[model samples]
Target: MSLGGESWRWLLASSSIPAIAVVLLRIGVPESPRWLLSQGRVDQARAVVERLRGNVEAFEDLVRNHVSARRVRYRELFGKKYWRNTAFGTIFYNAQVVPYFAIYTFLPLVLLKMGVGEEDTTSDGLLNLFLLAGSLGGLWLVAKMSRRGLTIWSFVFLIATMAPMAIWPDAPTALLFPLFLVFTFTMSAAVNLDQVYPPELFPTDLRSSGVGLLNGLSRVGSAIGTFLLPLALDGIGFSPTMLILTLVLVGGLVVSLLWAPETKNSTMD
Candidate 1:
């Protein structure tokens, strides 16, 4: 049933379909209402809000209270007022993604080391389901929980789930696999906040630039982690590598406690 030697080329090329679809779909998307309001386009912003079924009165209030017409330069993100946000965004994103990409990129090797065979398709399917469930759960919890609480607690649970395997790398497959699944679920859930937090952290004028900067930096971290993961596993072995990643999660927890803001019910302003 396997394909020819050129299968990798087709598989890689297939990704462009989604990319092209996104480009086409984005053509019809409206500009950000908040950004419009920031630019003094109150009527256009209100129209966008109304079309989206958002709170028009709130949008009006936002418009009325809008004071700044000055656009934020990228350098301002490093200024005193936004410096903590920049630091938090960069650290928080890297903390979540570094281990995330590293582990998932080499998941097969990870599972094999934990005694799961490549033939264990059922476990793979179950793990994917758990990831999906976790993502949905995260979306639900984003409304019910404070953003700070969710970010902190998710990091706490991620550390808890990972510490065991790091501490006992040779634990029984039964125990280790379940821990891995918990880690997967927690990671998937927490990753959703990546989409939520950065924009909220910045004002409308700076939002796009701030998010763009964070995303760019986060990808650098991901790239480095993905590249170094296999080398770490080879040189330091799985146990130490897991320990290192657990430390990274701990770093995330500390950063969240110190800097993650509660934007759950707050206005975009």
Candidate 2:
């Protein structure tokens, strides 16, 4: 599904619009001295800070502080504190992706099946509107919320929202669309927050590995979740059907709340 021939040309042309990226860097771009020292380039980092800050004294102090943060023992990832964090992260992180993608990606079709269509009141416009609201709502939530905090809040919304769709299958349209609206909104927040949480929790040594393993495992769960939806929910009722899935979220949240530490303000080194 990659770009082929003319598609490649078209894509490069589309991607070449980088004037703003250059402008933004000129306006303000702070280099990480930690990045320099990690690569064994201390002198280069010092030069960068001196040039950027215009005062060698203050800049050197800041670089020293950055270097202190960089002194992480990679072995700590295998320690007790980090071990369960990695395991729980891999399990639930993978678990959430399953149901989330199944529902969110095919939501329009799901809505149509539930009765939003060309002949329906909004004539498919409702789904488009829901997506727009969802995109904006996520942007707003992420700006002010911790990844874990946002994840917990989203789970509350999902339990409240999805339960009704399953419980009251014949629920009125008036009741349903709001659930749809909120479902899309919260799903965006949940998915993004889940993706952001893991790497920050790990030290630099295993950070990428931890996130990559979690993400790779979650992609498998997503495939299975999609497979189950058609085979199960489509045939059975959506209410009792999601009981197991709901429990999975509850389990993930419980683990995260009790054991998943806050990482929003923590520096990753």
Candidate 3:
């Protein structure tokens, strides 16, 4: 558990060991009924559905006309029917990535620059504790509120919180520190939308592909943000860099307004 220096590398690698356990756990699990149905295994799908659910009749009716043995094509992602969903998911995922990755990557450095000590465990612990609380609160909101509303409002809060620090990078630590907490709170709360919506937005036929596309493309954005953040911070200073980030959030807000659909308590199309 030692996490210093190269020990962190071992800690990261050790995390993957659980995946092996998971693979073993999946050895006897039934294939997804929908996937079985898609493969034209109607009897197997029905049996799996009956085993998993008490009623197969309702599930059958729901998927009866929709289920097909036709092969899925990658081009469906770009086809007229799904191209908009694809764009929305990718933008939604990647927009959050740029800010989240950059900010968290340099959070410690930002704190140090603001006069907090490098080894200030108390400050870091408190931030993480509040982040967990925010995540739970977000889960509550995700179930009760419109996904689009939560996302738009969270981006607004993020832009508002970033404004002060961007406008006055040298503000007193007391005034600026709470801004960090608020930013973290909103960012954590808003993360549910980023994580949930992509899967919900796509139909079962394309769900995995859509989510994979979202994740894969967003990671590229994260990598770019992580790489460019330091350069931007050093070259442009905190205020202008933050101003640019604010604009990025604005773009997210606009996308959510124009394209994001509400999926809470709603049936998938």
Candidate 4:
């Protein structure tokens, strides 16, 4: 933990240890029954499914119909029928990350700009914990809420929260924290929708492709936003940066309004 010159390496390695634990935990887990069935190992699939569900015979038709044996083709993602889904997923993902990542990656600096002392170390950790709690709360709410409604409202709230910072750049230092929490909480909910909606938008063959494309686009957006934010902060100043990010959220709202399909209560084909 106290590697002197290698302290930076320790910081980089912090998450790897937990990842190793996950790999170890997953090693003993059985292969998915649906996967086995798709592979033509009907007996093994039946055994696994029956062991888990106690009624494989009853669910056999459903599994056979639902799980496909065909490999996922990258080309299919760009095909006419699937292209909209691809674009929607990519844009939906980009919509959230561009602003959210900018805010997240620069929050400490933003706080400092708001007159919070540089030595205030506890705020970041506390804020992250609160954000994580909000994410979990959003996870719980997902089952009850429609994806389109949830996503639209989340973007609306994102715009609402950022509006204050954009309008009153020199706002009272006390107001920053609460406004930031609201923004983070709403953004987290939208992120949850980002994770949920993309896969559902595609069918079995294209689902992974859709989700992967969304995540890749999201990472790119995050990288670009993160890289640009400091320059924006220094060049145009904080209020303009806030307005830009608010516009990014507005883009998400527009996309959700125009393109996001309601998958709620509808069967995934």
Candidate 5:
């Protein structure tokens, strides 16, 4: 059944909310002092930190404790550690985005094929509702667990949820929607930690480059996955194809657990 007209309006309203947030960020956010230092403007960085901290003594302490702690130089992010973190972060971020796009593209198509007519957009409505709920839950998870913990648990949740979606395609809608909820919950929330986690793993000087490169590279993987999912869905069908999603989540879970160091209380100098 195709969604009734109200369903389209609901999706429009739902997506519009996030768009508003993005616009607010663009207008309201300020640049970081670390970026200034990373660009070789040490005086500008000192000025920014001094203004932020309200005392030169405290700022100097930060420079000594955090900024100058690294002897390899922040510029050495072009070296091995940066490359390793960037590569891992990029690959993992990409893995995270794949299932999201897969759902965006495949879910409606699947619903359409499964006998949802043009007049009913129940699947779309259900998806939008779950997405909102997942987002709210993710915010709570972040508030309660810290970003790193949520990042870890997001992958774990993804792995656990993928099992049901893979094995029980024939299940009733009530059960199936909850499985979608699990997957959507993690996928949506993972983006918050993606940028947060990588920079924490890198030194303060190289943080921006590390985060930028990783985020950029992950999108490449997402693009590839987006292109490939339809082909996989066409050839392998739902259950077998979705198992690939399960495996991807499993890989992400393993990779994240192994490589992502905890950064809950850490901060840049």
Candidate 6:
């Protein structure tokens, strides 16, 4: 049954429950020990560490010997030493998220073009479940595979899956559905690396600022792509739109091969 009328209002309003829960839960969260140490609250930092783990001696020694009090400026991300990381992060993140948000935002339209109507909630729900499974699989892959390998392979698989839809937009729903399931799975799996890479790319000093800037830029890219997607779909139709999105994935693959660093099992410094 298609939901109509004020059902959207309830759906929209229900989002606030999670928002309120997050706010409440955040109240009990402890401050980051590194940030605390950076602020020179040695005792408080040690206390926080002690609360979390039994052995605080190693943490204490590392803080005393290695860390220094310093504030990182956002402009430093563009400097020669860090510029490559910043560039890679910005491009890779935008590349994935742009098509990701665009497709999910207009999924119903895309599905309709592929012979699956909007009212086929069974397919939609299945796609969502595949996304969740892919996410869990991605977390496991992080432990089993190197960061660079996982990133590069995920992009490769994403392109492979999406290429079919681009080439055969009028393929029967039977074929299209399976292709879409693979695309959604690979896309969500690759997205897990978004959380893995940025912090590793920068040192502790610049971690927060670098991640913040990359995340902000990604939002802008996603918003622009989301805004333009419907126009592209309406103007050029499904096959061409899928072709364009596939190109975006190709760009990500190229950049990942060139710039994605191997941070797995590497020092944060």
Q: How accurate is candidate 1 locally (lDDT)?
A: 0.89
Task: Give me the candidate number with maximum TM-score.
Answer: 6
TM-scores, all models, native as reference: 0.93, 0.71, 0.87, 0.87, 0.75, 0.94
Candidate whose lDDT is highest: 1
- Write the residue-wise lDDT of candidate 3 on 1-269 in tens digits: 23667887886799789999999999979987777777777888888888877477776785667646556788899999888889888887777879889988888767875667778888899789879988999899888888888888888898888888788888998888788889888888888877788888877778888889889999999999889888998998777877787787888888888888877777654
lDDT of 2 by residue, 1-269 (tens): 14455786776677556866778767756556556656667788777777676667865665566543354555555577787877778666855676687776565556754566635656356656766776677777776887777777777777777777776767877787778677766665566666568877776656766777777878888888777775666677565556656666777767767666677877666
Per-residue lDDT for 1-269 in model 5, tens only? 14785787787789989898899889834456566655556677787766676567765665555443344454565575566566567657876887777667667665543345545666667667777877776666665776556766888878787777678777776676666666776677666666466777676656666777777777777787788878887898877778898888788777767766666677653
Tell me which of candidates 2 and 6 scores higher on lDDT.
6
Model 4 ranges off by over 4 Å: 1-6, 30-32, 54-58, 63-72
Superposed model 6: Cα runs more than 4 Å off: none
Q: How well does candidate 2 match the true structure, expressed as C-alpha RMSD?
A: 6.0
What's the C-alpha lDDT at position 212 in model 1? 98
Clashes of each: 0, 1, 0, 0, 10, 0
lDDT of each: 0.89, 0.68, 0.82, 0.80, 0.69, 0.88
Model 4, C-alpha of 173: deviation from truth (Å)? 1.6
- Per-residue alpha-carbon lDDT of candidate 4 for residues 1-269, written as tens digits (9 for 90 to 100): 24588788878899899999999999857765655666677788788776777576655776657555777679888898878777777777888889877877777778877667766767667678768987897897788899888888888988998888888978887897678878877777667777678878987556666778878879999999999999999999998988898888888889889888889878655
Model 1 residue 179 CA deviation in Å:
0.6
Poorly placed runs, candidate 1 (over 4 Å): none
Candidate 5 residue pairs in backbone clash: 1-115, 1-116, 1-117, 2-117, 2-118, 2-120, 2-121, 3-120, 3-121, 4-121
Weakest 10 consecutive residues, lDDT, candidate 5?
A: 66-75
* Tens digits of lDDT, candidate 1, 1-269: 15889998998999999999999999968988877777778888888899999998877777777796785578999999999999999999999999999999889889988889888898899789989999999888887888899999999999998998789988999999998899999899889999988889987778888999999999999999999999999999999999999999999899989998777767666
Query: Candidates 4 and 6: which is better by lDDT?
Result: 6
Candidate 3 lDDT:
0.82
